[model samples]
Target chain A: MKTYLPPKSTLIVWQIRVTVLLALLVAVLYWFIADYFLVLFCVSLVLAVVFNLIYFPAFLRCYSISVNQNAIIIKSGVFIKHERILPFPRMIYAEKQQTLVAKAFSVSALVLRVARAATLTVELKDNDIAEIMKAVAKWQ
Target chain B: MAVKLKITAHPIMIFYYLKPFWFVLIIPLIKAIVSAVIKAEVNNVLLNELFISVVLITYSVIKWKKLKINISSDFIEIYLGVVRRRYANIPINKISTIETTKSPLDYIFGTQKVKINTEAGKQGSADFWFKLNVGDVKKVTELYPEKVTPKTIKFSAVRVAVMAATSSSAFTGIVLVVPIINQAVRLLGTAVTDLLLDRINKIGQLFSKFMPPVVNTVTVVFLISYFIAFLISFFKSVNFKVVFAGKKTGVFSGLLVLRKVLFNTKSVNSVCIEQTPLMRFFARYLLRVGIGGYGNRKGDRAVVVPSAKRDEVHELFSVLFPKFEPADNKIKPHKNTRWRFYYLPTLFLAVSVILYLVLSYSFPVFKGLISFGFIVTACVLAYYYSLAEYNTKHSCISVAPVIYANYTRWSATREMFCEHNRIGIIHITRWPVDKRKNTCNVRLTVRSEAAESITVKHISYNELTDEIKSLYQI
Candidate 1:
């Protein structure tokens, strides 16, 4: 079975943007309630950085999706792994969505909708969308 | 063949609008009563109420005349709405279910309100009523002549009452009332609260003096609430029956308002058999089916049997899914997850002990009593947790042409059976601790628009994954 992963640069950029946003929010709070919030915010920021550093590698390694004859297999985890096997026949629809950041990075997200279940989303290069769509079309 | 059936100038439609007319006249009726009581002048007030009633009647009559219904070979078209002129064209094949409701007025007038539900239609479902002699229902069914000969199962009034008494609806009522009671207590001043508590304690003491051991106000309240819950449940599920026809399953239930629901068996995503703690003692189970568009306001599932014995459930399942035998395959969760069951209760017990010791210093008089109560509560909690653990250990999933899963949620045990291909998605979740323990939770969702899902917790992760892969041929 072949494996697919999201672009590493996109993940890193998204994480940095999120971290910067949180830091800005914390800095604004420090200006108002600076007594213990400063220490709390600093600790939280350090923990977030450490967490991302540890999690990103595991996420890249564990997060893999593949489509076979019968089903679509998605494996993802940081500390705990989850492997979902969604049958193609049961899928209601497949949607391709691209966020502004993802569009800039030339990566798109593919979501497969199944009834009454959590949709499976795979972030990959825009080129892969056609292949995935073809695969889903064949099954349907 | 095209068949045109227009619903217009029907007296039944007048009865349908009667409630709204009555609702509109409530203020006028109250005014008339007040005038009679105050000034002994009822003529003017009565005239005003009569005028309002006449206007409402005229409006209903106008609305009734504007409605048009056409039943064709391929589609059922409904044209109504005076100004906007709303038109709904529902295909015959897409019609999921047809629900009929009959009130006392319907019985008197020999009419029934029919709601035609289609698969996720834009208008939800088309609702209209016509003359009973019209045979509109037969005309609709004739479009799809391919029928399955259904086996009918009717429950006795006694059985229905018992089922109702043990239903979760009663528990829901009790749950609803608790918040209201708490709010009332809060709104009432401390003086009233103290007085009420004292009176309750006195009553408890009186009962205790006659009976052995000490009884408290809490115990009395609990007993009273339980009785109230039983009464509520009994009333909710008074008359219930299941009719299994070829291709369609009809559930006829309700006490004050008779509801008859006919749903296509092909649309049913899954069948669920639930047994609460009280139900276990009675050996009765509640059966419900998950369909895409047919559901109550509270839940997206329809009850086939509100309560039934083991044999009855087996009989029903035999007809519903002939290829799958529920008793043939039973797969249990791993035994290693027993520790997970006892963990929360043990933690709660420890916390209670610490709190009791700390609080004892403030209210020293009831120290011994509080400690005794805490110990008793802990023991009960431990016992219930053990039962829950046992139920979890017995949870299993069987896969064939159909998938049957037996799992426990809180104190209730549920057994669900569905077509393997109908399953929307399969999810396996594991926390960091669960990963280390090699145990995870598996959730199988049915392909329905409704929020119908089943989860089996603390099962061996690898074993379940391998089983699913092999069974589904993934």
Candidate 2:
């Protein structure tokens, strides 16, 4: 059995993206709302950014993929720990998609899909994806 | 023998090609005609509409001319698009369902609109849709050599009507009319809408004068919507018939616009027997099958029996899907966890009490009505919870080496029977509280039009593991 975790570089890319989005939202809200409540809004924005930064690392720590000879088990979810078992024989398709930020960090989202609409999507580095794909091909 | 034929759809395809722009075409034409009759002259808007209409018609003609189907021995190729040409080649054996239907125009012209579907295509839509002449439809059917005379089952008009009424909801009916109502309001202006509102208010006044004050305009509107939904469903389900031919099954339905769908029985994933709250009152169940390329969307279920008794459903199951017949062995939930059923209703009651107190404090004007509504809702939910608990006690999961069957009753009772191959993924969820109890929730998903899941809650951890291991041999 092999366990794979997402690389640390993805976290930096995610934080940067979230920060930029938050900055844009703050700018928009600033123009519309009253000046009296600006201080409160700024404080709330700071807290939101702080919370987001902390959440990514905790989430990355919790998420993991374990591949065995016959099946792959994925552990995810932030508050309620979710474990999904995907057997190689039942899997029909595997798709790899990369967002702009993920591409820059050499990370991609791998979607392991069974029949119909049941799919498990996870982010992993290119090397990890190749290894998982190889295991999937060997088993299936 | 090798077969090769090149053909085009019926010329009536042009009507469907222009269906998307119906409002654009009709609105301008009506305006022009009315203006000409009233003012004795056509304006710039009429000329602009004429130009646009000509361009749209020309485009449709070119598209119809370009669309061609090439049928070979092994595959069917479709050449599509006028501006940028592209063709799709589908192997004959890979096709799952060949659905034939007729719109009003197609019926008039003796043409059938055919949809070729495959399991591998996108969900909720057919892979290919085109029109074919009656003779061409017969020719297409000839591509499959195997033939057998099928046994037919027909539904009675009364049963169909009852089933339609039970299955229909006010939301669906409102969805159908909301867009048309919006269009009417936009075109007719505010004076017409105000007059309509006045008439509705007058009706509401009469209702308040005679019946209870609760039966207001809103309730009347809801009842009207529900009736419309029932009518739509009734029309769609009229003349519903099911045919079983060895390894194939065919469904024929629709009143004005006739439809015929043929699919292989081997491809069927799950056979579901369901009863909504309303159906429960009549002691009836709606039996449907889940196939790869059919019933992917809401209201499109491949119904085997619309409204039938328990024995009738079981009898039909033996003939229609003998492989997925209900099993006898049952696995009940852990008895200690039965209290979980009352958890939801308790929560609702608690929320209702909190809301009543808060509203009474904030809004003294509407206190009496708010309290009455909340109490009624909470009571109904509690009663429903009791019913669900009783039903769940009777429900159980039946599993053999190669087949899995689940029976569950909540707001609706759903029983699903399927073979092992249809099972896609199994998820075992265990929380902190569940771990303490040494039990877990096992959710089993099946391969169908949509990923339908059957969840067995509060089952012993070791028992579930053993059952899964024996079933899947993992």
Chain A: TM-score in each model: 0.81, 0.83
Q: What is the lDDT of residue B219 in candidate 2?
A: 49
Error of 1 at A112 (Å): 21
How well is each residue in B160-250 modelled by candidate 2, as lDDT tens digits?
8767866666443454344444433333333333444567977545544444333344445665877777787888888999988888788
Docking class of 1: incorrect
Per-residue accuracy of model 1 over A1-140 as CA lDDT, tens digit each: 55567777557645765677778878888888889796868787786776567766567767777878888898888778898998976654455555555666676667665543445454577677657755765564
Residue by residue across B122-229, what tens digits does model 1's lDDT show?
223333334442355555555556566657788888877767666655554454444444433332323343444567987545544543222234344755777677
Mark the 10 consecutive residues where model 2 chain B has the least summed lDDT.
B184-193
Shift in Å, residue B195, candidate 2: 30
For each candidate in the order shown, give its overall lDDT on alpha carbons: 0.67, 0.72
Candidate 2 achieves a global lDDT of 0.72
* Model 1: DockQ vs. true structure: 0.03
